[model samples]
Target chain A: MAFTLDEAQRIVSIALNHGRDAGWNPLSAVVLDAGGHPIAFARSDGASPGRYAIAEAKAYGAIMLGMGGRAQMARAEAQAYFMGTVNGVFGGKVLPVPGGVLVRDLDGAVIGAVGVTGDSSDNDAEAACAGITAVGYTPEP
Target chain B: MAFTLDEAQRIVSIALNHGRDAGWNPLSAVVLDAGGHPIAFARSDGASPGRYAIAEAKAYGAIMLGMGGRAQMARAEAQAYFMGTVNGVFGGKVLPVPGGVLVRDLDGAVIGAVGVTGDSSDNDAEAACAGITAVGYTPEP
Candidate 1:
């Protein structure tokens, strides 16, 4: 389940479509490689430049933490001092947000991730999920 | 003597010239802020896709520690350990290398920094200093 440019593009499309359907104006979407590197990104024309950074950060956070936002929130109690030390480490490349998704392969291997922004957290997660599903990969149960 | 984009670009150009002059083809150069943030970057087009990450690391290392390459050389130092730990905690964003130069203004105040890569650490540091000096600033006392 290696993520390619085509799949990342499709993810952006689904996210944008979801945005349109939800009456959200526009957004910037980013897809990260399995190593949490950027694979592809696109903005709906009017999105601000900062959106690009935020989208990348959100997607990166999802992959690095290896869990969705709720799970990340749950684990915060286990690793004390994780938050303060983490920000200085990536030098500001990660964000703690509910907009990133892990893309897994048939064998449950994590291959890549998708992040969506410019809307509410729920809507952003929904758009990312749509894209993940569009690629025929299932998210973690 | 702030580390302007122009100075950053010039550092890359200097480092690139040194590489080409010495027959080190397809090198990369990058400049970063005092906080290990990116300012400018360049690659020889046909270089590896990982060039972005590598160049970024060189720049990050230079800016984060206040001294260039100190972390990479003294890997066992507590400072290096802290830097590496911070990077892992932040998801690989902090990089400590020896090619970063602290930028200063006429009043002898540290304002920003510049970093360069694509050649040996010696050349990387040389070019960074060249660029900083070209902007009418000294590298260090």
Candidate 2:
């Protein structure tokens, strides 16, 4: 089944909640379905204006590459030249950072991805995973 | 004064509420500050994936051109060749059409712009004006 809008909003809400509870900086969260289209997005009240774009790009890259942010970072390191070309193609939207988390269904199929930005990359990824797990989905981070 | 995030979110919320109350199709709303960066955005559950992009572009164009969507439309008609080059410079984000409304402060200075989509252009513009007026700002459409 395709990702529902409610689920996407819930993911964003939960991710922001996690950030707030942890006393992290204001956050932005974006949920993208398997098709690499945003299902829902939100930026916290104090988040910088660019937060939404960064969060969306993180999720977009994760969903498009079929890997979590860490793996993308590793690949970016291993294949710098190729990644440079890919980043150009994606219009610099492929940020290989730790804030992107892949969501998986019971059958281990990729369903969508969640991206959070504001705090450090590790905290961002932690918030993303928290949201995915709260929604009863596995997070590949 | 700069636009606050709370005001932006309220605009999106009220715009979507107007669309629902009018029984129009699912809609997307985007609020961009004077600097042409999004402060808040939302797409109704059934809105198509591209709604966000369209809504954003509409508001971006209005804010960048210092006019409402109707004025932008007129400019597009009168200066199609120039508009083509301008659109290219903005990376095709200048959608000169109805549904974009300029938000003005009490002193009549442009503060921001709101864009709504997913219905007829007239209906979309109506919804955007509703939200802006509800927030006590004038809508220049």
- Worst ten-residue run, lDDT, model 2 chain A? A1-10
lDDT (tens digit, per residue) of candidate 1 on B46-98: 34546557666655554554554544555626466777686676567545555
Worst 10 residues of 1 chain A by lDDT: A40-49
lDDT of each: 0.63, 0.84
Could you tell me which residue pairs clash in candidate 1?
A89-B86, A90-B90, A90-B93, B61-B95, B61-B96, B61-B97, B68-B98, B69-B97, B69-B98
For the predicted complex of model 2, DockQ is 0.47
Docking quality category of candidate 2 according to DockQ thresholds: acceptable
lDDT string, candidate 2, B11-117, tens digits: 88888889999899998898888777777777887788898889988898888888898988888899988777877889888888899898878787779899899
- Interface RMSD, candidates in the order listed: 8.2, 2.1
lDDT of 2: 0.84
lDDT of 2 at A30: 84
